[model samples]
Target: MSIIGTIYEDVTTDVLGHIGSWQWLVTFISATLMVPSMLNQYEDMFLLEPPREIECDVSASSSVFNTSLCTYSVLNGTKVYKCTTWHVKFLWMIWFKKSWLIFCDHKIKLLSTTIICRLGLVFGCIIFGLIADSFGRKLAISIDVVAELGFRLILTFCDSESWFLLLIFLRSLFASANIYMGIILTCEIASSSWRTLLNAVVSIPRMLSAVCLVPLANVAPNSETFNFIACIFSASLLILLRWTPESPQWLLYNRGIPKAEKTILRAAKING
Candidate 1:
């Protein structure tokens, strides 16, 4: 009776922390290690003795990763900490509140969605590529970004699992298409000598964003927050497009000399 009573007391005290710790814990475990085989460094230390769980100090953490590492070291081995299931912080919770395992209660369904999204990309690339070639890069970009933004906004309000899946497919389609149109525009606008430099310059922001995403996610941890951010960015691009002209090369190739020449003159005047 004494042992059971003590165990129950401990369990009641520890339950809240475990439940709330998921957000930071998942983030830390997902971070890329400087050393891929981080466990190797502690091989000597862990060879004879496995570590026991120590109390995590939350006060010293600058980010979730720090908090997670402080909570438990990898040296403790899998037995001390194991993620049976995961949670997605932020707007992801609105739809996926129960489990990150996702709907249909099977891993295969999740895998199928990923496969479908990838296939959607293939069709998106081919279809949007031709659209950009047939119409203009500016128009294609505007169409694709607007569609993607709309889908993301719709996703926030979606409750039905089937509709959510469909929306994801649509978002993937538009996202892939937008990427193709963006690449086309970049290559079409830059001179041959400056093409490489233009590509590199444009890629820098994407790379920086990719690097900072996890940390930013820690701060803004909602799917809705990111969706809003994307919508604002897309809207800003639309506003900026008002001042920009259609690709002169696209006009020269697809339209006629007169229209292309007019666009160039307008652009030159704007620049001056």
Candidate 2:
């Protein structure tokens, strides 16, 4: 066939055929970075308003009622009256509890925020897929990391409910895009024999990251602290990216033989 095709075939057969340091390093970094991205995307679930004891005052009568649900309370036995003043006992200061007074009347709005965040995931996949194909996997991942970090930082300081919703959507959008891009890059660089195994291994970190959220939430004093810690963890990926190489397969198709050859040689040297 063509010169590029021959070189690509040789590289795939020779260099990638062996499981080596370069391949393992890339997979480890990519998988580890997925932790913060996932935490940022789904932290809202953990931050949802916890059940609270609510004491409501009845306007017409002197009777006060205590309930967990902030809806109407029975006064004597048959008379149901709407709650006027709310005495809410918060177990912890979370995003939902501190902001967006999501009582019984406004619980639907909280659900809407989660739905909007999920919608962002759908859009992120489509948009970033186009970006990865058009530009490059590395560029797409870099953009996703930076954008997710920026949105999350802003979200930490967000007080307004409207802004919080918007930031949640944007944050999840970019965070999720990195997941697929990382997977694609890893698979593209891996040997055929190792692809399935590497894919499964890489996914393990994602599950571990989800589990980590429990300790992270408990350790942080509040939602802002949780987000700040997540940001700090995410920032380390920037340094890791310095050692991360572009996919040689992508270079072969998009950037021609020379670029791909250089990457393959670098990987070989590192692997050696």
Candidate 3:
């Protein structure tokens, strides 16, 4: 809990200190490290003895993952299926709640979610890439962010398991699309030569978040709070709208120079 409190405070301070750069640095680093392996660094340290419950925990997590994956897929694209939202929310509760309060709850489910989160993230990025190329970076960013926000809000308020499940499905659905979208969209905003470097830099946060920052999740009280932390992280990235712009490619292709200039300038300032 202390760890999470410190990180939570640090995130706030990081945001205030570097509206454009440092905050994003943290974001980039964490997002770059967005794999389960990053946070598992210490499991071997303190809990190395491998508690007896670990086996049961692993088994349960696997089962939940398998089951939920199906549930999420079925309802994610279907807005009419209300149960989808509930399951999604439930996953957050299971993940962030870290409930010793429920079935085999310890680090198992959290670890599983952390593991799967970025897998979903990877797919999300790819989907966004397509959107950016087809629909335009600005539109992709806006749509992804809005959908992300809506999912978070819905999950945050949902009280029932059914509601939470649906929320989780919605969040994961969009998030899977968002990870790649952020990547392709940001790249579109940069200069051609610089695109590679900036795009690479943007990926740094997934790593940092996963490795250096995510363990703090262990310090948080529950899944709900963790979801909020993740939400804040996502929102911070979205707030880049003040500085973000439609990719110059789209502008160039569309033959809009004056329009592309400002976005180019901002990218240069931040990324240069």
Candidate closest to the true structure, highest lDDT: 2
Residue-wise C-alpha lDDT for candidate 3, range 1-272, written one tens digit per residue:
00112233232233233234633553353343233222223222222222211111222332232232213223234322111222223323442222122122356754554445445455566676676666676676566566665666555545564454445444554545434444554443333344466667666645575565534645544344445555565566566555445555466555566766665555445544
By TM-score, rank the candidates, best first. Answer: 2, 1, 3
Positional deviation of 42 in candidate 2, in angstroms?
3.1
Q: Candidate 1 lDDT, tens digit per residue, 153-261? A: 7765554657767876776676554443443444444444444554554454445544554444334444444555555555545454454446556666554568766
- Point out where model 3 deviates above 4 Å: 1-127, 189-196, 233-238, 254-258, 261-272
lDDT of candidate 2 over 1-272, digit per residue (tens): 01223355556558655588888988887787566656754445554444334344344454545443444655576655554454433333332223333344466776787789888888888888887777677787788778767886787666577788888888778777666666777787777678778777778766766666566555544456567667777777788778777777777777667877888888888877
The lDDT ranking, best first, is 2, 1, 3
Output the worst ten-in-a-row residue range by lDDT, candidate 1: 32-41
lDDT of 2 at 74: 57
What TM-score would every model get versus the actual structure? 0.58, 0.75, 0.50
**Candidate No. with top TM-score:** 2
Clashes of 2: 0
Regarding TM-score, does 2 or 3 come out ahead? 2
Global fold similarity of model 3 (TM-score): 0.50
In model 2, the runs with Cα more than 4 Å from the true position are: 1-10, 47-105, 209-221
Backbone clash count for every predicted candidate, in the order shown: 4, 0, 49
